[model samples]
Target: MFFALSKVLGFFALPSNLMISIGLVGALALFAGWVRLGGALLVISVLTLAVLGLSPLGNILLLVLEDRFPKPAENDNRPVAGIVVLGGSFDTIVAGARGEVALNESAERLTVIAELAKRYPEARIVFSGGQGTLFYSGATEAQVAARMFESFGIAPERITLEDRSRNTRENAVFSRDLVNPGAGERWLLVTSAYHMPRSVGCFRAAGFPVDAFPVDYRTRGYEDMTRPFRSVGEGLRRVDIAVREWVGLFVYRITGYTDALVPAPL
Candidate 1:
């Protein structure tokens, strides 16, 4: 029930979807002769879209989340018992059809596998992801990741695949159950920079304490805060990503998925 509700509500909650819906509704209202109401809605829709798509607001919002958890220091030599990489780095639909591993914009989540494998030869690796779409598809993200890992020459015994989890919370819960790391052992969580806060919160809430290994940063740094996007599509995409994450963070906290509103490094 929670998964279904989250998916449905999440669709409408996206800034792009909301703005597009408003524009469509306004068009329909104008067609029905609701002049004043239609004009107001249309004006609001256009202005909101312009602000989201042309301004630096998205970068500013993303920076707040991305900067919440920094990448582990270069000199912090720590023993990692295991590593967990969340899904959403692959395009399961394309991969399933083509029989080839296809990565999306979040490919860094998977590309980092090679570096990690070299760094921690002894650490067990867990890849957690399942079909997240409302409609059932034969493809699973974990399967695609498995192929990629094999191509990377990672040892089979060192890798564990948890393919049933469809969201971040389940990724943490299922990965923890699958590995059951020893107390005080360190585990590294690899995911996108903007997603680290919620990802960390979920793992912490599930009693799995893992250090953040953030990758796939969308923003350069504080400098991006003042820069406007040249392409409206690019800006809108960033805004959608940032807004969705912020909404997810709030929803997760209020729903008791995690005690922290914004999980910080220990």
Candidate 2:
């Protein structure tokens, strides 16, 4: 239910939603109360529309968020105990239940997982996900992740499954319960670079020492911030994703699901 609640709360967290709501309230007042209030609402909405259309506000938002979290590679010389793979849009599909796989825009995690399988054959592989659905499906997400590994020739004998997690916090908590991580057992956490902060935070919060190995780097721009942000749609999409993760982080902290302020070791 935390999962469902968080998803619902995210809708209210959008800047667009706030703009629309103000316009809506102004319209409602015009019908029952004041004409001036309605006019003010219309004015505000028009100004917002003009600003969003003319500027790279979305890119600026995404660019700033990406800058806030720096995911530099660690310069450590230590053998990892095991590799923990986090789930995302990477494996969500109609074929997920039937052992079929399709790639998200960034298929880096899947390829990186394959590399981990080859490099550390003896280290246990843990797959974490749940049946995060409002519709019927024959299998859990963990099953889908497992089958993808099967296609890559990973032995079923070496796989550990935690099929009841709906997000990163649960991914860490449930997988920890399944794997029983030992002290000094270093782990390489594989996920998109943009998502590394929350994933790493969740795992460490749940008592797992994971080295962040971020892939699928998304934020990029010219050294000159003055360059035109021509791709407003793409910029908006990135901003949306960044906003969602940040809201998720704050929500997790408030309910004690995570400590968002804790400086995550990136």
Candidate 3:
């Protein structure tokens, strides 16, 4: 129930979608001869879209979340017990249809596994992801990632696919139940940099302590604060991603899915 409601509300929560919705309603109002209300809404919609698209607002918003958990420094030789890669990296529908691995913008989340696998040859590799789309269902992310991992030369024996997780909370809970990490075992949690805070919070709440291995960074650094996107679509997409993460963090915290409102490195 919560999942369905969140999915529905999440659509309107995106600034791009919300602005378009306002514009549509405004057009309908104008057709009905409600000039004052219609004009106000239309102006609001256009102005909001312009600000979100042309300005550096999207980059600025994303930088906050991207900078929350800095990617762990390299050269650490600590023994790793496992590596857990969260979902949202692959285009499962396309992969299923095309008979190949089709990765999205978050491909780094999965691609980094190749490097990690070589670095920690004995570490257990776990891919947690199920069917995330509300209507479409075909090959799961884990199924697609399996093909990719095999292409990366990772042994099938070392891979564990938890294909039931549909969200970050589920990823944490399901992966923990599957791995059952020992007290001293070190595990790395891999996901997009902008999503690390919420992912870490969920893992922590699930009693799973894993070091953050943030990948698929959307921003360079603080310098990106003033940098604007080249296109409206690109800018709006960035804003949507950043806003969704912020909203997810808030909702997860309030719902007790995570204890931290903004999870930090531990």
Candidate 4:
């Protein structure tokens, strides 16, 4: 139920969708002869679009989330029992059709996994993801990840694929159960930097303590303020992702899926 609601609400929450919705409301109001109200709404919509697209607000907003978890120190030599990589890295349908893996913007999730696999050859490799789309009847993300991992020279014996999970919570719960690490064994949770807080919280909530290995940063740091906006479409897309992640954190905390609104490193 949560998954379905999130999907429907997510569409409406997108900046583009919100703009269209407000415009539609204004159109209906004008048709009903509420001229002032309609005009005000229309103006507000345009201003909102400009603020989100032309300004650095989107990057600033994303920076807050992205900065919550920093990249782990490269020199730290901790014993890792395994590495768990989340989904959202591949287009399962495209991969299934083309007989090749097609990574999305979050391809760093997989690439990092490959590098980590080589760094810790003795540690287990787990990929968690399932069929997340509502109607796409194609290969699961885990299936595609398995093939990709194999291509990266990670032996099949070292990989554990949890392909039944549909969301972040499921990723933690399902992967924890699949791996079932021993006492004092530490696992590294790899996901996008913007997504690490929620991912870590969910893993801790599921009784799986993991060292965060955040990657795929979307923001260029505080310096993004000086950078020019390359495209309005890209800015809006970043806003959408930031908004969804913020909402996910809030919802997860309230529902006890996480122990904190924003989990921090210990």
Clashes of each: 0, 0, 0, 0
- Clashing residue pairs in candidate 3 (N, C-alpha, C atoms within 3 angstroms): none
Give one digit per residue, the lDDT tens place, for model 3 in 99-118.
88898999999989999999
TM-score of 1: 0.98
Off by over 4 Å in 3: none
> Which is better, 2 or 3, measured by lDDT?
3
Q: What TM-score goes with each of the models?
A: 0.98, 0.78, 0.98, 0.94
Candidate 4, residues 1-266, lDDT tens digits: the string is: 87888788878878878986898898889999999999888888887876677677677777887888777688878878999999999988898888888999999999987789878889999999999987677789998998889889988899999999999999999998888878799888899999999999999999999998889998878998656467777777777788888888998999999879999988
Residue 51 displacement (Å), model 2: 4.7
Compute the lDDT of residue 2 as modeled in candidate 3: 76
State which candidate, 1 or 3, has the greater lDDT. 1
What would the TM-score be for candidate 3 when compared with the true structure? 0.98
Worst 10 residues of 4 by lDDT: 225-234
Predicted candidate 2 versus true structure: per-residue lDDT over 123-177, tens digit per residue? 7788777766544554666776777888889988888878888778889898888
